[model samples]
Target: MTLRSRLPELDDATMSAEQRRVLDDILSGPRGNLDGPFLAWVHSPQLADHAQRLGAFCRYHTSLPLRLTELAILTTAAWWKSQAEWQIHAPIALKAGLSESVVEALREGRQPTFERSDEVIVHRLASVLYQHRRVDQATYDRAVEAFGEEAVVELVGVLGYYALVAMTLNVFEVRRGDEPLPFDEP
Candidate 1:
């Protein structure tokens, strides 16, 4: 697939003081660079600032563990078929201890064979939430039983935040390098 970003990256000279400040904060944060949706978000600095703060919390400070958080993010990326999101988070998920089989299954649009109960819980929560747009009682109960209420809430936040990331990447046609689309065309 040929993908080109609809939004141009903002250079320092064109950025307002606010935009520059936001960009500076992002550069210094865990993200360490303005890539992906941030390239489009820089066009609206205020929104970028707030969105980045929320994203930072969800990604860095959430109650859910990194493995669970990454799983939820990968689930969202796969559901959206968001190449940029998938490319960004897939390795992170692997490093965070997600199995290659699970990541590969997600990449290939297949149900993954999860070894851990926590992995299964997270995947189920994400899949149910993405597919149904809400968690049913059984899945909600299972998630709470596995992760507790606070972590469950944070899991949902991770899912929702990455959904926005996927949507932004999709809408703006952000491509992660020259990598081909990971999944078959719909």
Candidate 2:
């Protein structure tokens, strides 16, 4: 199904000063362009500002390795069935060394067999949290054991930030174009 965005991008001429400022920040920041939920978020400039900062930290400064970080983000995207998030991150995940089989399994909603112990830990942490809304003690311990407590904290932050992104994309029906959606919509 094709879903139209509930909030269209604001024309620069119509933007309030705050919105323009946030837009400039987004354009100049690490992301370098507006896409996905940012298009919807610009409607609330303060929210766009704060959320973008948190996102930049979660996506860039987290202690987790790039591969593990992308794994966590993809896990969140799959759980949320967010096409926008999936499209943006799946290639990054593969380029960071996550196997194609793993990405395909995630897209297909299957348990992927991970060769790396760290991948297993990251996937388990995300899956348990999504399923139970909390990680089991064993899962938490495995995560902390694989990555330090600080990294574990950052992993959760990545998940939380992406979950917010997923909600925004889903609620606002954001999309790139008429391309097919990655996940089936009921």
Candidate 3:
């Protein structure tokens, strides 16, 4: 079942007019909020609170730009073969200006596409971290060279966390409301 379709409706106190407006603003596109499960899943008060907090943290503190964070999110989702997660993030990825080549590379698991420094860095570092679990000195040095030690750490952390989120959402069957699988339903 899809997330919004599965989740029960919240109490009237759970969603304010302002909150609904914010949700509408964030969704602002086709099929983005076509179901209650998705609306409830995303609008759950706790998650909304956490998202607000996470946004502030990421905006102010992370070494990764929002685009870079989105890259890590979408790539990890693709790597995990989580269609729901991928569909959710694809527009965010494009909105961040990641080129078609980069998106294809993430889908195809092709790293270092076009040899641009950041793409190479994110792809390679994410790949090695995904594959190796622990970055060896060589990989670490290269990643640090590409985006400093802090970014490398944050990138891995973000990728790992998003991978976990993707798995949880899939395993728990928390799909966006009306978000049928782009491929077959897993």
Candidate 4:
């Protein structure tokens, strides 16, 4: 789908004082650009600030290992068929040690072959949560048992945050980057 962004990139000269402050803060942080959803979010400066903060925690401060975190993100992106999210997160998943085969399986909507028991548990939890909108007791128990309650909580937070991002990207018709679409659309 071709999408024209409803919100244009706000230049420093065009921004309100509040928008400029928020944009500058985001630029100085780990996310060094007002790219992706942030471009749209800048339309609502308060929401942009809060969402970016939450995104930072989900992306950086989470208790789950980076591999598991990226796995959850990829699963969320694939579930939503969010091209922008998939394009952004897939490389990060690989860089964080997720196997190419597993990333490909999730991208193609196939069951992945996970070498680690932890990967299996994380994938199960994320998939069940996304598909069913709630995880069954067994999956929740397995996640907690494997990763501990804290990490499980953080995993759920990641799922929720990414789901929001994926929905926003899909709704806004956010364009994908140079990377090709990861899966065939139905």
The TM-score leader among the candidates is: 2
lDDT of 4 by residue, 29-147 (tens): 99787556777777789988999999999999998889999999999999989888888889899999999999999988899999999999999998887778899999999988998
Judge candidate 1 against the unseen true structure and give its global Cα lDDT, from 0 to 1: 0.87
- Write down the RMSD of all candidates, one decimal each: 2.3, 2.2, 5.4, 2.5
Work out the TM-score per prediction.
0.94, 0.96, 0.67, 0.92
Candidate scoring better on TM-score of 1 and 2: 2
lDDT of 3 by residue, 84-161 (tens): 667777777778777777776776556635445676667666777778776677777887887887887777767866
List the candidate 3 regions with Cα displacement exceeding 4 Å: 1-9, 13-52, 55-61, 108-112, 179-186
Candidate with better TM-score, 3 vs 4 = 4
* Candidate 2, residue 162: how far the Cα is off, in Å: 0.3
Q: What lDDT does each candidate get?
A: 0.87, 0.90, 0.63, 0.85
Ranking the candidates on lDDT from highest down gives: 2, 1, 4, 3
For candidate 2, the 10 contiguous residues with the lowest summed lDDT are: 1-10
Residue 174 displacement (Å), model 3? 2.5
Q: Candidate 1: list runs displaced more than 4 Å.
A: 1-4
Clashing pairs in 2: none
Comparing 1 and 3 by lDDT, which wins? 1
Candidate of highest lDDT:
2
TM-score winner between candidates 1 and 4: 1
